[model samples]
Target chain A: MSLAFTRRALLKTAAAGAAAAALSRRTAAQASGRVVVVGGGFGGATCARELKRKGLAVTLVEANAVYTACPFSNAVLAGLRPIETQQFNLDAVEKEGIAIIRQRAVRADPQARRVVLEDGSSQDYDRLVLSPGIDIRFDALPGYDEAAAGTMPHAWKAGEQTILLRRQLEAMDDGGTFVMVAPANPFRCPPGPYERASLIAHYFKTHKPRSKLLILDAKDSFSKQRLFQAAWQELYPGMIEWVSLSSGGKVIEVDAKTRTLVTDFGRHTGDVVNVIPPQRAGQIAQAGGAADRTGWCPIDPVTFESRLQPNVHVIGDASIAGGMPKSAFSANAQGKVCAAAVASLLRGEAPAEPKLINTCYSLVAPDYGISVAGVYNPRNGVLTDVEGAGGTSPVSAPPSFRAQEAVYAEAWFQTIAREVYG
Target chain B: MARLASVLTMGGMMSVAVVVMVKTMPAAAQGVAPPGATSCSGCHGPGVSDAAVPPLHGRPSEEIVAAMQEYRNGRRPATVMDRVAKGFTDEETRAIASWLSQQP
Candidate 1:
């Protein structure tokens, strides 16, 4: 109901581009209005920071003071890197003159254009950006409630569960079997499950050479499947086995207490069971009525404005961006596009034609990396992958090529992190 | 004025200035960031990044255009640039490069 304006709300932020100057001139008083952003991940942070950079009143709402990034949290699972390396703060964002709200957004009222926080206060916005990332559908998956997640950690959201899964693997016997249930498609990070399995297998090959990784996948195919399978054979030979959907890889139920997973055809019990359950848009996105029947937000490809809700732009894993995998890279690109679009719309103009690019790098081993790249063009509000551009890494590339990809993977993470967090 | 312009363009950059037809360019692409320039920061790294990929900021527009053209025509080898280069036309590439050439 009330506008959540902090002391810095009226601060003269630096770096207002010429475009913003023209936009403010065109729209007059309304151009520099409030743009409240929810969820402070790659997508939200970039969008909020960009909006502020354009001289708009911006507020970033995040539940956590420190963000634990999911991009390279896999390395932390292997003990190759510490969790601290994956953690980042919003100090850089705050310095840019955007107000940061350290409270969970419990609800969003689209009619009022108000975002109500858990503490009962709300922020009204001229344009609202929702980037709440993904929320696991604990109810959709049988026997996999929020409580069950404590026993059989999914490690999908990173941070606490990542450490849990890794700690469990460390405590298991050397010959112990580790079963990981991969979720279905349209989920965040298509190559994540395979990458986690590979990294965990890498840890095993060194500390527990006799250990095995059994991946129960919901789909028959995945992003860069051939590259991942090839790397698995070359590096962790006979240490990993994959069961696809038709082979009864879909888990019907999970018993966290027994560390067991039940599929339609068989039951699998492991020393450590990791169930990556089905996922949908975060609760706040659904609460805001941004999501549709698909349980994901359908957005205009150019503007990222929710098709279901007016004036609310959804990005990151929450929105169903066509041809773009739900990746941090895609989110960052979309966020930038959306910021420009929002700024233009505030001045009552159609957004410019947007060109979005996404490159997702996955580490098959610490030294072996693979990627899937795509460039998308939005035509008639639908995004199509540009012809003759962007595809998977060379499946048959030499070890040297794989090693170079691994180095680039680390660099990509660092580059994207700086672009968003700073 | 000569010193400032020289420092800003870095020599090769000014050559493209006349070729760039800013009047004919799309209004949205006129400023610091071009049509797809912001997308580059997602991977190429932002300012002063030691992040493996070469920073495109402050590079000469002509050099950037040449590299992109080479990548597009398969004359250059790259992990991802080859694929990305094909997405942009020579005009759009020049527009993006010109913006990067002026970055501080």
Candidate 2:
């Protein structure tokens, strides 16, 4: 079918289907129950939106009135995109019949089936879904604490810190050294550090051509390492240097005043330091008693129900989802799956088996991108990667192909944002 | 005696087959969406139309199934679909195609 014709037909069909669903939902609304969602990022927001769409009453408790996405925050840091582009209001979510509470969730009482807010008020729920993303572990690195973060911005959460990092880069003189300390594995966004390095390099290449970037990585290998390295060599040769853990790249301590990084083997001084510390489940997860010794909540891969708490499920970065890295796309997918499970549980039905998929794209430059895609299935109580299903972008792809991937990457961000927030 | 024994065995097998069919028909009718299909909505579902990625909804089941098989088999050129199509088994692909075919 012609593309235009197909789009028109699909729109008509969607409108008809929506009308039918709305009519049925109105009749079924009498039996629907309340679903309380904590955190308002990709996973929580998507879950809340999906539940509300299904005629269920949903309450979304988020500390921030506006959510700034982390997916493309690197672009903001590099001055390629404005921070405002990453920020979203809750108006779209509110229009979907979700009760938006702009207050911090202090605790989750599973036994009481209620969540306490910072204001001392508690909201009762028939079911609770937690999508609180992650918390920085200050103790992971000695001398690297919350206070240190102001001087050495991580900018991982995307907001004021992002602006700080951008301003620091802009202020640095030509030929100055920029240093980045990457986090360990099982953290949010495995390829994030490398992408940040690439974008920062891009900035320096354009404005401060004589500047240098040093990356101190915790892990020896990273997601799409070969692709990133190749792009760096081709795009900004001699401008970026990556030090692996085996080569004393792991930063064990930091001095914010001196702008120094201490590793097991040696110490390095730089003009600008970006320290991304280790991470754990968001504090509310720990407060709720959902997190375990590992500092992440264990979940049933099929239903995302917390092994620690009944009727309270955790998704996104806080949940130990097997074989699924913590990415916005993964969280978005998990959100939909969890929403379906929560809906089924509310109706006193068995949750269906879930198949999950994730595709993460990283931009090395404004016009160069690469991606990895995977499909997963719940097997033996854990999500396992389906063999022969997903793969990374071809290593030998031409520049034109890479540029096209970048376009798709931006489109994906736009589409996902609409899906989750709207 | 031989003829009588053969007839009894055939009758028993036929009755079991009928019972199995009766048990499975309802599940087939109430078709649950297979895993991984919902994720497609992020890019290929509603509110996304870039011409690079085609819409999967409202397509014929046979057409959808054929396209996926081609992508999986490397018979079709793709930017990312080939990698994505490999993630599903033929049966899973069929299930996804059937689900999408029924969608508006």
Candidate 3:
């Protein structure tokens, strides 16, 4: 059967159960009304599935037919996991009666509650869910553009770029340097760059002992600094080096052809260069008028409804969720909350005060792991970390403890992937 | 406490120690999963090949409560649950367990 939808059954259900919901504070709720979700990554896919489960007609628009997840992608680069394992085809969700539109969302017509696709077709929604993860600010730095990405290889989005960087590493001479330039604050996965460095360092230790890895960081410190530094000392000592911003580690420009990064005071060259650029909300979010000057969509803490657009909600990395980092775990959590709120709004009921949780586990090596977690509760109109109840992996833990965490890290992936994708 | 807060302000995901105390919880509600309870499914999700974490659906509420209380009080050793358990009140935990129990 065609995958766009199985409307024969859906129309029968909609006709049988005409909803009798009260008029919403803003607009009347249609229990069987359409919800169009943009982006099929963690947040949008989860939201689409949840809305369908709530007995709503849901459509998910995505640029790619298949999704490549970013979580655990660093392992793919280090040869710890195969790239095939990172891919997800939404067969499970498709069978659940969700219409998966394989097309790019070019614009969002919030005023008409419609989404315009690259092919000029449009889907009208009673409610719109925008979960466009992030867009790399391509020319934010000089000498770096779409063409430069072919050479430098951001690999930040996973998939083909991830393999490009890995192949480059494999082809490099044993003694050649692999350098990564990490972006400043407000990026996806705060602990990600350090974890990449650690796992890559592990790969070097086993295959090319003479090779070295260098990190040119925009910030002087990062999440789980002590744990990562300690793991580097114990697992791959003297094989990795970090350059903090105070020491001119921040790259002002780059020469992609020459593989050189121009910092404030000096120039550094590497056999392999990975540039993680600054980011903003995806194109649709900006086009839909959901995003603000900060390059992120501001939303109500309770319902995640866009502050700028009525009947439109933004979640995941694109939304400014307080005290929540841009991680898949956070996106999944936000997806649930946003889905529930949309259901309630359609039913003309006030949204509930929900508690959100985030746990980010980073593998410093195949066997060594570190994490940071928090529970975000609503406080004074914002989500705040619950007092006395959130923290990172404890310092000075034994090797066995780290090993156990590594096991849990894999479980975390298996469980979340099944929940969201299926 | 002041020093710890200063450290947390950097990453903003740190926690303070909590004294675990058991208290009377509300009777479980039916129909829908609680707000905080949905987050649990992100990790303790559907029973698929049975990995390191156990799926929570359909377990007895009493059994789930006892386990959560133990983790909250540090009596049960866990990689991360000890910290997560302290985030919820006894009432919230009981409601979630009740919801999970009602699930098929």
State in Å the error of residue A100, model 3. Answer: 1.3
Summing lDDT over every window of 10 consecutive residues in candidate 2 chain A, give the lowest-scoring window: A12-21
Candidate 1 — which residues are off by over 4 angstroms?
A1-32, B1-32
Interface RMSD of each: 7.1, 12.6, 5.3
Clashing residue pairs in candidate 2 (N, C-alpha, C atoms within 3 angstroms): A355-B35, A355-B36, A389-B86, A389-B87
Chain A TM-score of each candidate structure, as shown: 0.92, 0.92, 0.92
For candidate 1 chain A, the 10 contiguous residues with the lowest summed lDDT are A10-19
lDDT of 2 by residue, A218-294 (tens): 98999999999999999999999999999989998899999899999989988888998899999889999999998
Model 1 lDDT tens row, A221-308: 9888899898888899999999999999988888878888899998899988888889999989998999997789999988999999
Q: What docking tier does model 3 reach?
A: acceptable
Write one digit per residue (lDDT tens) for candidate 3, span B1-104. Answer: 34323322421211110001111222342376686888888887744423456666655688778878987998766668778888989999999888876654
What TM-score fits each model? Answer: 0.89, 0.87, 0.88
Whole-model Cα lDDT of every candidate shown, in order: 0.83, 0.83, 0.82
Error of 2 at B10 (Å): 54
